[model samples]
Target: MNILSQVTRIKNAIAEVLTGKDELVELTMIAIVNKGHLLLEDVPGTGKTVLAKSLARLIEGDFKRIQFTPDILPADITGIQFFHPKHQEFEMRPGPVMTNILLADEINRATPRAQSSLLEVMEERQVTIDGETLKLPSPFLVIATQNPIESHGTFPLPEAQLDRFFMKLPSGYPDFHQEKEMLHMYRTKNPQDTLKPVFSLEDILVMQQEVQETRVSDEVENYLLSVVQATRSHEFIENGISPRGTLAFMRAAQGAAYIQGRAFVKPDDVQFVAPYVLAHRLVLTMEGTMRKTKEQVLKEILESINVPVESEAGR
Candidate 1:
């Protein structure tokens, strides 16, 4: 099947259990193709777990969930080396992170030590235990989530740690119709239980390469830079987009254009993917935080910049 056809199949498979989350599903696929991780913020019972679990099933990847808590230890997640008395030697055991899809449910509930343990694994795709390093399986992606409504007993992720995530999603509440449809669908069965992989890991790797090759013209490049520059100079902003963020911003637009069956990145592609890729990396001033949200400030920044014409972006 072609790339668009494969994307359709994957999205449709997720729709079996989720409703009105097409954008969420689409962005998740983009993240996979671009080799990025997602951090979802929402209250419980809004399909956060279900979405991640369903994607793991649809991709046929090994899925593991770690319900982080205050008492959880770093060794519990990065694995531990224990002496085997029977064999009179030490044994190496891998943790849940060894899987392809890891659901870090309520990630903020864990202590800093436990939370920091994932930083290296997330960035390097490898974990170290007792002076030994173990490379993670292919297509490793972390879909971490935290409850937004509750602050008690939660340690919020710092700016440094937050920057490690490629994109952050609010995972908004479902609309009335979407919620109704979801209720009716789940009344019968958990559709994910019957799900199977629609595409292989190799297929995804190939798609990643194709997406990386998508062209970004000079006009579009300047337009994207203008937006990033605005974030740094905005009156309400304390900190702006970083060099790492700029790279992710460009790559996400490439994936967006590729998904639309285009060989070249357009201003629209950058605009569409900008909020997801840039909002999380922003740091608002104390006054800005009280006056507006990161998304609002990002929206303003986007509005201030002029989008390059198609002829200018690419022909």
Candidate 2:
């Protein structure tokens, strides 16, 4: 019931291991509580994988990781139905997708066929194996990490595939002070080794249910819709946020409010989560790509829109 305290404990727990990345941890938590998938575009050592592992421990949930490569097949990720000679029958085996938290590491490395395999489970939270459908664990989340700098042997995710993610974050490098702190933190011991769960899977489920209950007003709804419309007509954008994205934008605002321990959504909440939810979904025009990044163009759009009165937001 106390969303702030619960979120605070979880963030502090993750901060112990992920030094100087407080904001990243917060966004990651928001995505998790919303039961949305995460797409992390970061360089090799920005603690993307650690973030997933830390979340798994925080909720006392199952954590499974798959290192995606070109040779990875759909069966490798979703499991296969194999025949047992001794038993004289066929048995179904579930893949890593069955876990509570799944880390699809270097997701861009896998071929389109292999990548497409996750489409069903991610959206439906269930896997079909030889005509038998198996449900994934409760509070399931996919934290898919990809290397942004490496193009060698990498297959870029198509627009449809990218839309599956709830948000895309670049886990930027730590600052000087944070980097120095990290060296000492790891010098003593791996913080994760002693890390403990801040909340149970049941708690997470409760938060998910409760986050949606956070109120979104007509004013805030209109403001959000305006942003979605901006992307569609914006000169620099080739493709704007989809209808699914529009829903995600609103949901993310609710999640942001829930994390802040607020009972109602505000224009501030909508503004705060805009970049994380919308930037990656925007397809930039050639001119846009050459002139500005997605975040920059999105910022322009945000500046152009008028924010609603704060007092009226709670009503």
Candidate 3:
């Protein structure tokens, strides 16, 4: 199947369980296609876990869920070297992170050390244990969930760790009709069991490669940079999108273009995917926080930023 067809099939498969959050689902797909980790922050009972599972199932990837808690240790996540009497050497056991699709359930509940263990794997796709580096499975994607409503027992993720994630998505509660449909659909049995893979791991990898080849015009490139530059200069934001954030935005826009069956990105593609790609990387000033929601601030920034009509016309 073509890249667009693959994306559509994947979306339809996940939508079987996720229901009406098409935009969020699409963003999740884009992140995966772009080979970026995702952070799903929302209240409980919003199907965050289910969404992760559904994505795993639909992609036919090896899925592992790590329940992050205060008691969890870094060794528990990255595994440890254990002495083996029979082999006369220490054996390294792989952790849940070894899998292709990793669901870090309630990631905030884990202590800083446990959370820090993920940094290397998330960025480099490899884990260093006992000074030995082990590569993770191909097409590795982490879909982490955090409850935004509770802060009691949870260790807040540091800004640096937060920046590691490509996009921080809020999987909000479903609408009235969507919830009703969900109730009806799950009245007798769970719907997730019925979900099947629409594409294989190899197919996903192919699409990721295809996305890289998607042409991003100089105009769109300049527009993307302009938006990122604006965020840095904005009075409301204490710190804005980083260089890494700019790269993430570009990848996400390419993913969006691939999803739309386009080989080249347009200005609209960047705007459509900007908020999810940029919002989490932003740290608003206290005044900005008091005055507006991050989403509101992002929207205003997008509105205020001018789009380049042509690439060389200005030059």
Candidate 4:
């Protein structure tokens, strides 16, 4: 609960600029606490870039931004080795990925090779250049933004890379009142300017450890697995949730429980986080897509599974 207060401060601070999206904010925080990266898939001018930057500013850590483009090279993000004339040696230079918070803007616009540069660092938190590997800073998080409406000069992210993201969220347009408030605030000054850091990188690292410590009862754990397994046997799904995704779902459930001041995860915790955690990882059959979206398919999976009783859930 003490951690809840700190995280609440962070959420409220970010809400100043990202109006009317509290659930999205909560989900984003969950991703952070679980040490998972995010992919923001939405149309332009939906505050995707602003959200990424605000999150970076909210934590006391190094922040870096990379604008993904067609010409971007692998070395541009993961770092490069350059020859030093005076030293007569090749010096390894760290790129934007070396920072604590990285905002990968319009990531889909980059070539696949350039985008693939992030795989190692995202999964292993280390970058290799010229046969030398360097560990990235602790609490490293990548909040990547992509415009779903644009296709020209953009390369689609492969399924392997997509699975790396813990969640793919949409930054939808704000409601009327929220938009009005945003306009009023923008007339005077950017709301993000007044934002301040509420927690430190060290705090985040500690909180991440706490999230993993959150308990999952045997029945609740089985329920979670049942949902994942259903995805695999579903008639419409070509590929179901991967083992990595199964682990991600458990981690996300733990984060959800921690946020709600609970020491143990419940079936509700898994239900709340399952859709976001599983949607993108699925490879649907063409018939499935024609009948329903990935979200809809996931919804069916959740509905079909029997949730554990309260007694079984240790509630």
Best by lDDT: 2
Per-residue lDDT value at 157 in model 2: 95
Q: Which window of 10 residues has the lowest lDDT sum in candidate 1?
A: 1-10
What C-alpha lDDT do the candidate models reach, one value each? Answer: 0.89, 0.91, 0.86, 0.88
Steric clash pairs (candidate 4): none
On a 0 to 100 scale, what is the lDDT of residue 300 in model 4? 89
Q: In model 3, where do residues sit more than 4 Å from their true spots?
A: 85-89, 308-315
Alpha-carbon shift of residue 224 in model 2 (angstroms): 0.7
204-268 in candidate 2: lDDT tens per residue?
99888988889998889999999999999999999999999999999999999889898889998
Worst lDDT window (10 residues) for model 4?
1-10
Clashes per model (N, Cα, C within 3 A): 0, 0, 0, 0
TM-score of each: 0.98, 0.98, 0.94, 0.96
**Candidate 1 — which pairs collide?**
none
| lDDT digits (tens) for residues 61-172 of candidate 4 | 7789999999999999998999999999998888999998899999999988888888668998999998998999999889898888888999989888899999888889
| C-alpha RMSD between model 4 and the true structure | 1.4
User: In model 3, what are the clashing residue pairs, if there are any?
Assistant: none
Candidate rank order under lDDT = 2, 1, 4, 3
